[model samples]
Target: MIEIDTKKLVIGMYVARLDRPWLETSFLFQGFRIENNHQIEQLQTFCKTVKIDEEQSSPLVSFEAFKPSTGRLNGTPPPPTAAPQDQKARFYEDMAQAKSVYDNVSGSLNKVLTEFRLNNYIAIPEVKSCVQSVIGNIMHNPNALVLLSNLRSKHQHSAKHSVNTCIYATLFGRYLAFNPEQLATLSTAALLHDVGEIMLPKTIVDKKPDELSAEEIAQSQLHTQYGADMLRKITELPAEVAEVAHSHHERIDGNGYPRGLKETEITLMAKIIGIINEYERLTNNPNPKLQLSSSDALKAIYALRDSCFDAGLVEGLIKCLGIYPIGSVVLLNNGSTGIVIGMRQDNHLLPTVMIIRDPTGELRHPPKAINLDKFRDKEGKPILLISKVLEVNSVDDDLRDYILAELVTKNKPM
Candidate 1:
């Protein structure tokens, strides 16, 4: 048994002992693998030290709590996510392709969202094509599309939310090993999930979710039925799309709106989109100023495991997006600032980062890139550990603009 400070424990460590008796803590098992940050938080809250079984499997990485950081950088580089086992193309190459596909799909989303808002109808052919293209992009290289989704927009809440949710759903679906046909249906459901919100009063729809009154909250919940009803009327779209639209709000423990669905009753796609929808919503909330950082949002959703979502699928989101997901701006333990550009499935803590600023708080003309898992000091210890995640809005306008405009054009990390 290896004893370490509670704060030093990373995700993959196996805990065989605790400073305090196990009975004192809420842990259900005598010994257990720390699977997510919630468990880590619990340990930190209750225990001063823990003994980890090094031999038991888990990712060997640790990240500090989320906080804001200052300073901006000028380097423009493409955001790239960690590719699946059979990576088809390099980061730059796939990034360009992903941009083209994303642009086309976003245009379609904006037009359809506008059309639905005006006339309550959208062309099925146009949306189906978008789904196919998005799925193809994900299959080719998952990095590019995800980076595109991370590019925040301050306008057209409905349109941007749909596209962002779609990107998140496809990424989650790919991780779940869904077939292409399954992806198409899942993507379609995701992209059009909120079309029914147009039926809502402009006053209710326009307000930040937290600002809504009790009556407005109840009225807003009707969008699921409104959306499902709209989708069901479209003969060309699959029945599952409507089902997902309606049931995505349903929780696993049967407390959700529209219809309270238990675990087995909800379709897998609805369940998948349900988790992604909440993550996307929190990440891209009605108020950008109130948007939760990626890791912060993950922690919020992770708290709802089993009761609000499937436990395994919740882990899938962490695996797919990582603790500090791609496009996250973070401060390193060494006092450098960087953006997360990639994630390794095995270890959610250790990700590939593009360094934006040096320790002196000066911008790196061309940002340096390194994989935390591979980069080490002279003693072979990892040199850079993420100290804190910077919120998107917390970044100054120039930094936000730099991320939106410059980050897309650069080809490779290093």
Candidate 2:
């Protein structure tokens, strides 16, 4: 660490220490990136000099100046080191493992949420264990859990939403190269993001904002505050975790509730959870009118870029999920219908698919899975390209049925 005058502070530097004890200030953490002009000003108010951790500082330009990789909205990033040639085979193998992981996590979350409803207490160790398990699985292979999350049961919306949000947030965090500690905190915060809802009456929580009285709307907004208060009472969690629960609802434009914080006032972890939480809700909202398909949700969030979320983080989210995220059903150039089963790091557009219907629109009794990236015609040209994305219910057969069928075939025989 090197001591530097606060006057010399710039964006991207990591402040390790201040001349004064950190507890005296409002800054949440003892160490943090000087991410904006406002933070520099805040530091100047608190300290004339600080110590910088040169190794931890981001070498990239300031968050405001950084640009998302090109051709993203236009195209996918160049393929990572060529993925395994038999990725489809590996995906199924991973799917079986991921299903087991999902079952475990779902059970744990149900217990936690149930406990919170009965008594306002949470078991910190149980949450930490679940977070570690999820992290290990995602780091092993990201596709399996991602695909399973999309198949969440509608009956268990609240519990499953938290689990899916935790997975998505962890995946996004991993894409950003967050350290283990940061990932743990992010995952834990996501797991409990909506915990405050447990405190509200079922009638109020179940109704949509339009159906609610003004008082009901106000009570609903208190979830953020309730969640933050709950976490603060749990001394085991890091302070930032509580901060995320409090500020995830806060928009960059200062229109958000609980606290109308704007831009820099929101912490980075909160921003990450905010983006993922919205995406999850849009895709899985109980109100069908409010629900959006994965592609459309991405577009909606992209439109809010700087005003509601960090632009670079949104781009990171798009990249992590891909143009046609797993579980999206699409029409193929071959006039067939299929569901995206896996993604290729090299090309997001050409994902692996499980063909459920033939060109004649007839259901294929046993769906056939193929890697679009590797499929070729007799002439050695690509055999199929995505013609259009379809709503999950576009086909006569339920999409969930197809996904469950595939999972059953991949997992141990019943």
Candidate 3:
């Protein structure tokens, strides 16, 4: 019923969920059950020795392997996919347009970073308003969520961070069926989530991973307090906006920085912000050293459910967002590459995609959307199982041109 992090897992506790890699053919493990202290220790030792990095590792067993055993554990079965709901599932074109808009917005936000800082502790009203507007824009145009995922990058400065969080929070608010007013408010809070980072040293903010000392980590932790204080100075903003700004880093398990507040202590909006914040940070492949493939990122979060996130919320995000969240590059089963655009309520797995490039290095024809759910291969099988999800790209590939070229290639005389 309850999930615990693998690190803190105790023996004799009933297993809430069992995880194995999706790539494996079999899921049988002799010691998967932990009924007593000795069994727990053995499992812990086995996990530590062979577990790999939880954040980047794949489940060692497949869903098929674990399916038969779920009845014994009482864990909920994986829900049916959304793909079959539509009479004709077509998603590719919509996602492309969304991604195009997101790329432009992220470009503009990145341009403003020079005006912001982590140590100044100044809440620029203009910047805050800009962030608010961005959230509002996305809320009015729900399709914008596709672009938000792509906007996450290694640069952790306030401008980009605020926009990314706002997009995420707003999308989540929409999924929760909150009205426009509530969604706007959540977006504003997300936009200003990191306004406090201004007080820290630029050296610390931009520190190389290897260069950070214990003191730097402690100093970095103060940004939450600093951000809350900065937001309080804004007289016109809603009062609760500061909560998202303040608690975006606080975890459900009390393992996060600042106050180390647990689930009940953190606001519901703040909890949403925290989940999306970490998701963006980890999935964005922000640091050169920590880039994760889209598949790997999903796997990491799947393992983290309940322990690091709210189970219902996590499932909601996965359902609303789908396997390949926007901005992720995936290799389709038919030897083509595309970027995810958005989820189809009817079919989450076969989302609308923008075919940016082809295996022959050609762009799509007219850069139209391709609905994989309706796309079948020559063999009459679905031709779009995602092979990999692309995250951080140092160069901007002209996705529009790429998509068009792919179509051109497809129609060329054999």
- True-structure RMSD, every candidate: 16.0, 13.0, 17.4
Deviation in Å, model 3, residue 90 alpha carbon: 15
In model 2, pairs of residues that clash are: 71-75, 79-346
Give the true-structure RMSD of model 3: 17.4
Model 1 regions lying over 4 Å from their true place? 1-93, 117-120, 153-156, 377-381, 409-414
Q: What's the distance in Å from true for residue 327, model 2?
A: 1.2
Cα lDDT tens digits, model 1, 38-142, are 889999998988876543434454322311233335864444433532132345555666778878888998788778777878888889878877876665456
CA lDDT, every prediction? 0.77, 0.79, 0.59
Ten-residue region with minimum lDDT total, candidate 1 = 62-71
Could you tell me the lDDT of residue 34 within candidate 2? 71
TM-score of each: 0.73, 0.75, 0.63
Kindly list the per-residue Cα lDDT of model 3 for residues 1-414, writing each as its tens digit. Answer: 223445655433333233543224121221122335765565454443222221111233122422224342466666544343231222223234445545555555554343454244333555455554555445333544435445334445556666676777777776786654676678777766776665678888777545789988888888888878877776777777887778877778888777888878888888888878877666554465576655566567767777777777777877766777766677777667777665555556777676666777576554445667777768878866777665445224355334333423243221
User: How many collisions per candidate?
Assistant: 2, 2, 40
Best by TM-score: 2
Output the worst ten-in-a-row residue range by lDDT, candidate 2.
61-70
